[model samples]
Target: MQKGKIGVSSDNLFPIIKKFLYSDHDIFLREIVSNAVDATQKLKTLAARGETAVSVENAKVSVSFDAEAKTITVSDNGIGMTAEEVEKYINQIAFSGANEFLDKYKDDANAIIGHFGLGFYSSFMVSHEVEVVTKSYKEGSTAVRWTCDGSPEYTLEEAERAGNGTDIIMHVNEESEEFLDKARLGEILNKYCKFLPIPVVFGKKTEWKEGKEVETEEDNQLNDVAPAWTKKPVDLKDEDYSSFYRQLYPMGEDPLFNIHLNVDYPFELTGILYFPKLKNTIEVQKNKIQLYCNQVFVTDSVEGIVPDFLTLLHGVIDSPDIPLNVSRSYLQSDSNVKKISSHITKKVADRLSQLFKENREEFEKKWDDLKIFIEYGMLSEEKFEEKAKSFFLFKTTDGKYFTLEEYEKLIADSQTDKDNNLIYLYTSNEEEQFTFIQEAKNKGYDVLVMDDVLSTHLINKFEQQYNNKRFVRIDSDVVNNLIRKEDESEHLTVAEREELSPVFQSVCPADNGVNYVVDFKSMGENGQPMVITRNEFMRRMKDMSKLQGGGGMNFYGDLPESLNLVVNTDHPLVKKVLAEKEAALSADLETVNAALAMLKAEQESLEKAKEGKKEEEVAAADNEKLEELQKNISNLEGEKRGKLEAFGKDNKLAKQMVDLALLANGLLKGADLDKFVRRSVELIN
Candidate 1:
């Protein structure tokens, strides 16, 4: 027997291990089990190379817990350390045996998992004392038992063992007693070691007998020694991949498609990525991709390992190249991580491109569900954007899907404006903007359904990518103005427009956070009598603000919505309203206009007489007369506007037209909608 303090530069090493070695105390089980797996794999590697006579078959790692004893033990059957090897590796705190093993067996040690020797110390986090009983595979080697409390001091001595292996026994501390529970220990094992390369046993398999679960003789293996990702892609079928996905996420829906990633030249990376049916919201669908180093689970937050948008995908990504101690800042700067990120982005884009090229009809069927993810990727990753352009689809309001290039060709001849810019018409809501979409379709223009949360940002990216291309919402303007082929003239004169503007403006909802600007356009008698449209730029900005939801963008979000109330002058209803207004207020306006003309003439004459004159040179009486003339002119104008507004308020047809436009835009609600219904019935009657 021998006793000594652990070799270390600092006396605070054990305290650091106990308090801050790992973020969670439950991680101790993973560290211990992973070490056991490494030991077991090392034996297999040595046996394969004919370096050892030890049999590698039926080798396994088992985790058992004693509730009353408040202890957890992880045992394995593999290459273990002799007494001298234990003194060197165990006495030294940071010395890693896996690293030295890899240096010796660099070519054949692919399955070795441990990179940091401190993994053994992690057991001290949850234990008041930890004991290791190991027997090396060397012929006539003596078994040894190593013991250490939650301190630098430890004991090593010869012990008895059945075979070559190691057993880690942890006496649970007061605060870490939860690990003594079998169920809790099983959960931790399932989370971190469920896909380990070695079979991991927890306890006896259970059977439902005598109306209760009874432990059977069969060992209850907690892990699948070989997961789908560890096998060659050729060996996996659709069902096999789906079964693996179910194992990863028990309650998740089946994925739309999958990309089996196998890269070895640049850096060893093998895993399966599945494109899940993402919800319209991006945040809720993130952090589903689990990352691993070799077969040991690292994290589910893979934002840095893959691009931010790729976080939307669900799957396993195993790479020994990615260090086990993951930090966001470290991942961002690591060269290997950058390469892996680029590779994943390329893989996703390539898979999508293949799906589109091979079976476009099937791809189109899934476009609506796959759109948000693709759009988010294009908006976030530039390299992905370059590749995604080949597979990105534009879905029309009529449910037809087309690639960007194909749609560009389809609309190049018809949708190009007079400025030689290609106009891509789109609608966020097909039902609410049905009138606008139909009008566009009537003119042989196709409208896309850009309704995803990322659509606004994506369109902005597209606009930046192609200066000659523009994305215009179908309801952003009248059909004639949406893709202008030539200059157009207003059908109503200035005087006529002035008379009609007030009539439409009077009925526009004032309390709603919406500002309506009345404008007249020539759409022929066949066009709708009224149409509501929003400014594309402003609306897109507000949409982006809502999606991003913070910072200076809140300004745009808080601003009231502004829409164009386009009244078709050629429509018979609008013509009738103009005629009716003329009959009702023309006489009253004329009387007021005559009085305003005389007052304005006197005022202009007085202003001409005082031209370039000093204030002192102008007569006091002349100034007083000018002031009186201005007051009378102002009063007459007010009187004229009052009569026009009064006539507008009394005009039911004008109010009904405004309400119809509001209703079509989904803005009219509550009492206004009810009023529109009642007024609509009366008008029909």
Candidate 2:
């Protein structure tokens, strides 16, 4: 027996390994099992090269634990380390400038483990003592045993073994005794080694015999040695990709499609990415994309390794170029990782473009499910945005799909405004905004359905990306004004508009958090009598504020909703309401208006006298006289408005028109809706 301390400058290495080498102590199994796999694979390579005569046909890694004894062992049938190799690889920590490395990475546990080749030592994280019984495949080589008790000190001695392989036996510490549980060990193995190239055995296969589970003689392999992603894309069928998806997500809905990634040059990368069916909401399950290094599971939090938007995809990504132990910050800065991310984004875009080109009808069927993902990618990744334009679809209200370029061309002649701006009309809800959508359709305009949670942000991004293009919600303005080709002629004169404004405003619902402005537009005799529309910019800001939840946007959210009660002047009902108001309140309004006119004339003359004069230059009596004239004019105008509003309240047709607009907007609810319904029944009776 030969005993010696591990050749390291610091005596505190063991404690550091046990306490800070890994964030999660459970990763010890992954490290040890991974090492076993490397050894087994190396032996296979040597045998294939005719460097060794040993057969590697039965090569496998097995994990077993003795709960009573509190020991877990990982054994492998492969090229094991000789005593000299053990001295060089295990006894002597291979990291140069050890003190500096330790100091630089003491706070970053993951960086410490992989950066300094401390994978084998991770076993100390869960073990108070660990033993390695290895036999080299070299002819006439002696088997050796290595023992360490969570310290730098270790014992190397000759040991008996039946085969040329290695066994890592860990005496789990008290805190990590949970590893001794069979289920726990099995879970760890399944998570970290489920797709290893080499078969991994956890225990014996079981069967339900004699009304109870009985262990069979067959080894229960925990992994698929050759998963779907490891094979060539041409060799895989659609069902094969689906089956792999089920293996990754047992309960998830089947994905829309998949992109097989197999790149060897610049960087080694292989994996399958599935476009999962997503909900309209952005509150999705991210971190579903499992990342691996040579099939050894590294992490599921692949936010930086892939573009942020791509994290919504589910499946596996195995890249030897990505180090096993890495921080998100390191991944963000790594040049190779950047290259891999760019390649993945391009591949995804190309795959989508191909799918759209090959079967556009089928692509349209999947557009509702794929819109959020494609839009999110376009908003987040600039390169992806450039590629996505070829496949990103604009789904219209009538269930037609068109690419950005296609849709732009289709609407160029019809929807372009006099300002040379192309207008893209859209609706958030097909049912709620049905009236607005129909009005747009009546004029031969195509309205898109932009209902995803990210739609507002995406629309903002689109406006910034394309010149002379605007995305307007169909209900944002009256149809005639939405894509105005020229200045529209008003049907009512200034005095007529002023007299009718108070009448329409009087019946507008005084709902909390709602403000209504009466507006008039000539929409011809066939148009609806009244329409309620929201301002596009203000509404979008509020929508974004609700989605993003903070910052200056909150100001928009907190403001009352401003809606335009657009009264179509050409409609017969509005014409009747105006005529009725003129007859009922004409005398009272005339008396008030005559007094208001005289007071306004006096006030305007006084205001004109002081137009170029500073405050002190104006006489005190003149300023007082102007203030008195302004008060009298305001009072008389209020009196005139009061008379008009009184007549408006008595006009049932006016109230009915306002209610119809509210009902169409889906804003009439509870008592207000009940009132409207009751009034309609009374009028009909």
Candidate 3:
């Protein structure tokens, strides 16, 4: 027997590997199994080159657990290390400038492990003692055994003869006794070796015997050896891709569609990306895209590797060129990753465009299920935004669909405003906003249905993307103003508006944190007596603030809602109210107006005299007189308004009109709505 220490510049190497080399010690199984695969692959390469004399037909790797002995072994029938090769590869740790390297990278041990070729040593992380019994394939070569107990020192000695191969036997440590469990070992093997190019066996297949699962004689292979992504796209059928998706996500719903990526020129990347039925919540479905390196499972948290929006997609991405840190625990940013991300974004856009071009009716049929993903991608990725325009769709309230260009053309002539800007009318709820939608349709305009959770952000993005284009909700304004074609003619003179303003104000609801403004517009006599509209800018800000939940926008979300009470001057009911008010308050309003005119003329004369003068130059006596006159005029006006308010209170028509408008807008609730119902009954009677 010959024994020596592992050639390392530091005595603390083993401790570091056990404690910090990998973020999670569970990765030790992946590292060991990967090494075994590498050995198997290399032997196959040499045998194919006619450089090896041994038969290569029955090559395989196997993992087994011994509960009684508290040991787990990974064996491979492939090229094994000779004693001399072990001395060079296993004994000598490849890290140069050991002290400085450790000092500089101790905090980044997980990343440094792959860089310094410490894969084999990771076995010590979960085992108190590890033994490597290897027999080289070289003719006349004797078998050798290497044993170490989580230390720098090791023993090398001659062992019993065996077929050419290697066996890694680990005596599970007390802290890591979980590795000794048969089910645990099977789980680790399945996770890391599920798609390996070579078959990996772990115990025998099981069958239901009596009432419990019993082992069968057939070997239970854990990996597919040739997953779907490894094959060419032309060779795969639609069902093949779908079957692979089901294999990856057993419990996921049927995908809406998929994008098969197989690129070779810029960077080697192959994967099947499935568009799952994403929940309205963006967070609950993220990190479902599993990333792989040469069929070895790296991670599912592929946020940086793919575009942020693509994280909502679920599937497997297997690429040998993706850069992985030491333990493959996470992704490292590099040019290849960026190129891959851009490629994926392009592929996704291309697939959607193709589907749309092939059969638009089918695309529109699936739009509801696929809306959030496409919108998110367009909103977040600029390159994707440019590509998405080709296939993006807008569904009208009437259940018709149009592309961006097509929709713009369909509404360009009529929806264009006096300012030459095109307006897109949209409704959040087809049922709740049915009245508003019908009104818009009555004006020869189409209203779109934008009810997705991300619609607020998406429309905001579209406004920036297109020139002279605006998205207006159906209920945001009166039908005439929604897409104004020309300047509106005055329906009521200043004197007539002043006489009626206070009457509506008195009957309008009190401050419920909602600011109400009374306005008059001439729709024909057939228009509704009253309707409510909201300012577009303020409403959008509030909606976006609720979605973003941050910054000064949140202040907008907390502010009171403001609505406009639009009374139709042409409606017979509103006209009747105005005529009644004129008859009741005409005498009182006439006297107040005469006195108010005299006080206003005097105040104007005084203000004209002081127009260009500084405050000191204006006489204090004149200022005082002007203030007294203004106060008297204001009091007289207040008295006039009081008379009008009293008249409005007594007139149930005014209150009923306001309630009708509120009800149209879905704002009148509870007692107020009940009052409207009772008043309507009495007025009809």
Instruction: Identify the candidate with maximal lDDT.
Output: 1
Q: State TM-scores per candidate.
A: 0.95, 0.93, 0.91
Model 3, position 364: C-alpha lDDT score: 91
The deviation in Å at residue 277 for candidate 3 is 3.1
lDDT digits (tens) for residues 502-539 of candidate 2: 89999998855699999899988999999999999999
Residue pairs with backbone overlap in model 2: none
- In candidate 1, the residue pairs with backbone N, CA or C atoms under 3 Å apart (3 or more residues apart, or in different chains) clash, namely none
Rank the candidate models, highest TM-score first: 1, 2, 3
Candidates' lDDT values, in order? 0.87, 0.85, 0.84
RMSD of 1: 2.2
**Residue 562 displacement (Å), model 1:** 1.5
RMSD of 2: 4.6
How would you encode candidate 1's per-residue C-alpha lDDT over 1-685 as one tens digit per residue? Answer: 9998889888898889878768776788888899999999999999999999899889999889888988889999999989999988889977889999999999988588888888899888888899999999999999999999977788999999999999999998898887777788888999999999999999999999999999999999988888999999999899999999999999999999899999996999999999888777675756588888888887787877888888888999998888556111133348898898899899889999999899999998888788889888888788888988888988887778888889999999999999999999998888888888888999999889888788888889889889999999888888899999988875667867776777788878889778989898988899989998899889887888887785778989988999999999889998999888878777887877788778888898999999999999999999999988888888877777777778888889989988878887788899989988999899899
- CA RMSD for every model? 2.2, 4.6, 4.9
Clashing pairs for model 3 are 114-326
Put the candidates in lDDT order, highest first: 1, 2, 3
Each model's total of backbone clashes? 0, 0, 1
Q: Which residues of candidate 1, in runs, are more than 4 Å off?
A: 326-332, 602-631
